[model samples]
Target: MEISSGVAAPETRKCPECGSAVPVDERYADWCSACDWNVDPGAADPEPGRIAAARRRLAQEYGDQLAAEMERAADGGGPPARDTATVLASGISLLVHGMTALLVVTGVLLVVLGWETGVQPVIGVLLLGTASVLRPRPVRLPKDAPVLYRADAPRLFELIDEVGAAIGTTGVDAVVVAPDANAAVTGYGLRGRRMLLLGLGLWEILPPQQRVALLGHELGHFAHGDIRRARLTHGALHSLSVWLHVLAPMPAVRLLDRFVNAATFVPRWAVYGLLLLLDRLTLRASQRAEYLADASAARAGSTEAAVGLMDRLLILGSVEAELRRESVAAQMLGGRGGREARDRAEEGLWERLALHAGAVPEHEYERLRRVAARRGHSVDSTHPPTHLRRRVAASGGSHPAQVVYEGPRAAAIAAELAPARTSLARRVIRDLAG
Candidate 1:
């Protein structure tokens, strides 16, 4: 076998913090993740013994966390009302009821009040739709793929099989590394279908255990059939909501907003109250989905490791926020990510947890565009806030962690976030759900 060499070469030394190869620069002094232990830089190289010893200790600690996750996976009931299904379900029911009423009313009006013909208004709306289509805005997608492809796809395939063997899963359908910073799992739940999405950023930065933890959580989503259920439930509601939006006289607007600002108080108050209730209910459904995804991820792996994953997401928020503040225009426009989106298909559990914990750095406000101009979706343009995800990944739920994920150069190159990317997911879901 080739002997380890160079700065990156595995010497008789390694960082106690991460198992990544280190050179003689810190012969004895190394960072350790398992115990937060540090070695002495002045000491001699003991790669022969220290490395194995460190692995042993770290493995034990990590294994314990993994075991707990496995148990939770077997016994935990996916997500509860916290998963947001009930609220979404209610919203759908209510909206459908209203739509049915409107459809009936509109149908009657077509017969009596609209032109004398039975189909006048319906035809009118369809004609308007056709007109809208003809005048639709021009589309512009980046000529380049969303993200640079990384990681060996074949290796991912092999690992999927390995994970299935370890956990008794039939395995996932496809593993895609998003060129974008966000990740997700999507598929219709039928006899044989499943898909997984991972951010290219994730592959560039995550520790092995944290990466596995993420995969475990994803697998849990699969085993529990959460993806299928979430998709079906959401698709049904979304479709119905869209139909309602089209049919209702004012589905998208808050009743009060239509004229309340102009004058008249009582009718406006009532409409505001009704709209508030609906918003709250819809928000609750979103919240529930988030919680469920978190619980599902926890079921798959060590809760602690899952928690460790947050460090990077928090860093992402800070990075974007810093970017946004770089320019006055960005501060005004705030068009960028700053962070959060669980999936291309749906919200993820990570961001939700982070939001619940208030993970975003304070400055992640309107000024995010400066950084967004370049990094944009790499951090800002996505659906959720970034800092919160970092918080959730580092801490569990709203609770915080004493220590969190950080890169090999966290202290030196604050801009780089190789160490904390795994943690962004949970925080994003939490924020989005909220």
Candidate 2:
């Protein structure tokens, strides 16, 4: 295997193919005792920083708290779904919290850069504000953007309205389901229209209550004003990335393109790497928002249901994901939407290779994933970490709760939760009417 130029290993060598560590017998100096992975004794060992960064991300996701939550979610079946209003609050909390956290950080950047700190944050809030004002505007299912709901999300919109009424989720305009098992609500229209998308899988597997809870979580984003914040921040970043990429997709920007791809060298995982390090800071900021949403659910009198909703969502997103990898692959490459086969093939290879040996250390990768899986993938920033949510649920506390719920769950637990489950029937007619 070719060694990555930027990274070097420490002390022992590991097999790129199987990840078995090569033992030092000196007798078989060039070979791995377990996997026969070739080695170069002269290789420059990488500094410990890379491994350290990866370890932090893993620890944040899998920490004992996250693990316990996963277990609790399994035992609970799913949250109760009697009230829809509270659920909307929960979802909105996530969006608002995420935006507020980002703006807080951006404010720091502007201040430190000696720019108009007030102006920066004001601009940030305003940008997102535009999206927020139109937050409840639903996405009109377009022929171009086909509704591809995940197995989950059968009553997505109804729940959206049910929970939203309490949270002031207004003007439910349009809805669409993507093949991907993620949900997002957007404000569309020139002045900003309200829209939402629930991953079909989210609707499929999560118990109805959990489904409402999921909606609450998303709509909560709008309620907390996160939808607006996300809009501005994401828009700025997307434009900046695209413009900057024109200058430097790799590193240094040419003189003319300098303003364009300013963040070009900003690697994807690297940003997450930074966030991973600051996970606690992010969590601390978001936890409050979550509390508010949880309370929102409680106020709507669906506390137990909210918790159950969260549990079921955790269970489904994890298991269903593995079974539907092919669909994800299709959506990623735009399916038959007109991407070139050769280009798509190349992209696939790169994505597949990202998880391979020595791209980052195999032991390191496994170590992190092992920890992350304990809590499920959502701890990263999608939902409340299972532990925290379960704690509130069990405690009988209800408020807006927004914790990171971004990844897959434990397979065994998911399988157990998945059995005997029936998907909420899709109100395809409801979507078609629009």
Candidate 3:
């Protein structure tokens, strides 16, 4: 492998030919053991056809796995059993917690021993104080955004309740509207109360069935209890990071800090490295979770409707990128003020969406497929590649799209949400202009 300048090769690597798991060893730098794919710095690029075929095989592998899992689920198999990744992630989380407990006990003992030996207790107290600093704040949404409660937006709540029923889950605790091209479900507070952030851009474009698919996918995360598991893992990893950040401000105790870090370095790094590995291992589980969510959407509506939602998402992403990178400034930046600027930005985005909707050429989709295939899976990617997801969606036999709501009901939901969406747009414009 040709290592980047000033950076060493990672402890693990993937096989270039098949994208299969490569067993890590001292010889990993030389070649992939799984497929014997060598990294030759001087080798000329291979033909595009060979690379394309390799990527296709990798995507097919993922698609096949998903298909078999879906088949088993359909056969009345209870939810798919926890795989190796989930188990390992749970184990790592427990290990982190255990280490934290060990630190607490050590600090207590040190304080007791220091008092008995006529040594100052300040040192021990300091260590305990550092532990206190490790308490993580819960994740929160932007406070500037407009939030709607069930009481405030009964019609919107009704819509949420309707979608939740379709997906076999309860409605969210709160909903926040934002100016963006995406929507998400997250939580805040000790109880991890679920909050949904709805993007106006997404809401404006989706058909009723596609809207159901979108809502189903978001609520599916909550129904499956993925949020709590994610929080546990996040808390474990973040505690370590908080402690590291605490250590950085102690220049007066540089020697002490160095000594302490040296003593704990290997253990600390082992934990960090293990956490990263766990992330990699659990990535497939995360992707599987996404697929399950997609399946929920399909079950709630039609397979075709769910695929349509995904297709719209693909097109939206392309248009959003184009507007943000190439066209937004020219149209929106020279405005008299933030409101006009915001209006221009929104108009530009909508215009582009209009241009592409049902009009994006086959060549555009082919280009998107090619890019997705080439991109494959990255270490940090939480979801599967778009092309692979589209393939999985297509694999399910077609069914008539379910209509869970009439036009009037859809209009009621949109009408209730209009004010919040407008407020969000204004806030975004102000922020951008400032």
Model 1 quality (TM-score)? 0.40
* Local distance difference test, each candidate: 0.40, 0.44, 0.63
lDDT of 1 at 289: 33
The top-ranked prediction according to TM-score is 3
lDDT of 3 at 386: 66
Candidate 3 is scored at a TM of: 0.70
Q: Model 2: which ten-residue window has the lowest total lDDT?
A: 421-430
Ordered by TM-score, highest first, the candidates read 3, 2, 1
**1-434: candidate 2 lDDT, tens digit per residue:** 88678864455656677877654333224345454344323342243554334444444554455434433443563432223433343444445445545655665555556355457656655545544442333324556443423233333344456677766654245665443345666666565666677554454444434555666666776776532234443343333233233333443357745544454445544444333433333333344445445545443435666765544434343334333443355445444654463244323331232232113333432333333344333433434455455555555544443321222322332332232121211121112122
What is residue 20's positional error in candidate 1, in angstroms? 33
Better of 1 and 3 by lDDT: 3
**Per-candidate TM-score against the hidden true structure:** 0.40, 0.41, 0.70
| Candidate 2, residue 35: lDDT | 48
Q: On lDDT, who's better, 2 or 3? A: 3
Question: Which RMSD does model 1 reach against the true structure?
Answer: 17.9
Looking at candidate 3, the ten consecutive residues that score lowest on lDDT are 38-47
